[model samples]
Target: MQSSYLLTLLLFAVNAFAVSLPIRIVSWNVRFDADASTRQDGEKPWSTILCGIWSERCRKPHVIELLKNEAANTASPTIIGLQEVLDNQLEDIKGGLGSTWQHIGFGRDDGKKAGEYSPILYNTDALTLVFSEMKWLSPTPDEVSFGWGAGSRRVVTIGVFEHKATGKRFIHANTHLDNVSSEARSEGIKVVASRIKAVREQFGPLGATLTGDFNSEPNQDAYQTLEDMDFLTEVSKSEAVKIRNLDLTYTGFESEAGFSRIDFVWFGPTEQHFYAAQSWEVVNNVVDGVFISDHRLVVADLTAL
Candidate 1:
């Protein structure tokens, strides 16, 4: 009888040690232009025009449904890093997502003067925020202006969280890079790469993940710069060809033949154990059969190192 009890305890211990630490993350640029007009009444005309573009192009109801679907499909992700989300939209998402998900974000565009921002949302039940901060990509971190004229303004949101159950901690960095100028994109990549390196240096290797709509494709030079820095692993490259062949994430308003794979989820090289990286296009609704938001949500599952 004693032998049976000992054997059972041994098995339980082994099972506990062998269990995989699974984390699901979703990155989406919700089209910042959509909420531009929601500012105080009589906001700037430029902001109104931006909001109008968003309303016409972005399907908020469909997006909320997509978020709910992702949460349900994954049984809820520990962390969700989002870009181009305005303050008002974050509130709407909170209402829709219920009290389970907690979020942190700040606007890089106009700062407190205006209310736009990018937010990182996480399941409060699974992870607790340890630290959070927002910083610009410009050489001058204190400035609020568009870092390099890379479309309005941009900023990166960083958060460190501890797994409520296992006590394991990891950092998640989210950002939206310049979409227009190659120089801006290149500079933005360096700034973010430097930030990631600094985090790993302080937190130890393999202790972080970076996700966002970088606005640069896998084959682009900006992405290559990151690869050279050894700061991130483009999940798609490690994934199988069959999986990589899926439709690209960004479709310019109208359905066109060529779409770019600009959205990405990257992990440091130290995180090699987490393999078989993959991405999916969450195509739910279409206008006249044309997709919404020039971009799609890309997700990947990784085995903890």
Candidate 2:
């Protein structure tokens, strides 16, 4: 009888722990130069690397399918923060994922005339957008310069969402730091940390998640700055979860040696509400020996804290 009582207490504890949270998040940086059709237009490559010849065949369907598969695999993320997506590309992603997601973002680089922008997509049924803003990472502020002396331009998009059912609020920030200039990357990290600090101070304690493709590796100064700021905890390092795809996410076409695990997802003080987090690279969508993007999708799951 004592053993039965102890077992019942343990089960109750597990159930109580599970009901404490109410949100899940997914974050990724889809490579900018994924479209082959744009190559023929004589436009400069969005990526830092050399973009090969354009393929006449469309890879959008395959790319969309992979995104859908990622979403389907998760326990229904309440919010998804994405970077490197074009204005029209969001439509494609929404179409692929069906009616469950609604998105918000602005063209931070010259009103969408050039360069890629970061965007956030959320499950409409789970969360409602309360506020959103876009800002540049360079000295020019509104200009399109790749602030970190990077070979490409980058921006950060932030969204505040309110849970429709629980009324709980959380902020999500998404960005792609400079890939070329070490200085720019460092400056970008500082900018992000400052902004998050300011947000928390003004808005009070709330759950927050920052997701993006930070270009630099884990041990780099850029990543270390953010870590020291107490702004976030790297989900990849969590003890409760074991995420796969630990190698290079950047696959250079058919090149076997090409890979870099530069993508990441992070959480702030309210992160304890989440139960799990992870990342994945869609390696199966290669077409004729070429990959859908140079980078893979990084995903994470959170319950609530």
Candidate 3:
């Protein structure tokens, strides 16, 4: 009789500890490392470049404000995966985000500070970083080099975090696959999948969320490669979730077309594990008729049950 009572008490205790936690994750491509002196096609010299600097500055404040709002509203700290970030832009964003925000990533060009970055940012007060890495999307992933006919040396940033309150850990990976090379996109995705699986295997039953600008549409092979993985599901397509602003992610100053829905947030571990998107949004990032980013932001309100 005493053993039965003890068993009942233990079950209750376990049930009490099984509380679900909500985490807000965002993925954005914030243009790139272009300054006022940069050049472009089909425009007067220094005209388009000067306008780009002004437009980016206008959008910077809005992006900072949105991050602050998200941090304030969520119980768990918000995780942001940013692509097309330059070293200067990263510092500027960190300053705007305040001291509590921390990030992990490196430039893909020289592996120091030459090229674009795919950085993952998180609030230090709500989470602790366990492990982080940056790898090139090439046949020789360990070194900074391009492969598979890639136009540039693309990279992926990954971080494993432990929730401060719940004692739960999860992996967050970020990347921007090559836009020009079809071979690079397909092979790059396979590498990402293998890396995600390897991380989970080493860490034990932990769920993972990968967010990025894949540069591929739903019908493309790169997108299909992800769907065939059988573990990852598009957060926007999840049942009971809301999808907003279902238009093109890349505006290219309204010149580019057919590149809709390239930015995405995918949730993995679809088995018995706890992962679901309650709501999703492709944030309308234009402010006062000026686009903040060439690529719109994608956000997901997720719950780990």
Tell me the whole-model lDDT of each prediction, alpha carbons only: 0.65, 0.65, 0.78
In the range 168-287, model 2's lDDT, one tens digit per residue, is 667788888887888888888777766665666676665678888888788886788787766578776664354553456555455444567677778866334433433333243355
Tally clashing residue pairs in candidate 3: 0
Worst 10 residues of 3 by lDDT: 39-48
What TM-score goes with each of the models? 0.78, 0.77, 0.86
lDDT per residue as tens, model 1, 22-56: 67667776665443555223212113335445544
Model 3: residues with Cα > 4 Å off, grouped in runs = 1-17, 37-57, 255-259
Q: How does model 1 fare in lDDT? A: 0.65
Worst 10 residues of 1 by lDDT: 39-48
Question: Which runs in model 1 stand beyond 4 Å of their true positions?
Answer: 1-19, 33-58, 113-115, 239-245, 256-258, 271-290
Ranking by TM-score: 3, 1, 2
Q: Is candidate 1 or candidate 3 better by lDDT?
A: 3
RMSD of candidates 1 onward, in order: 6.7, 8.5, 5.1
| TM-score of model 3 vs. true structure | 0.86
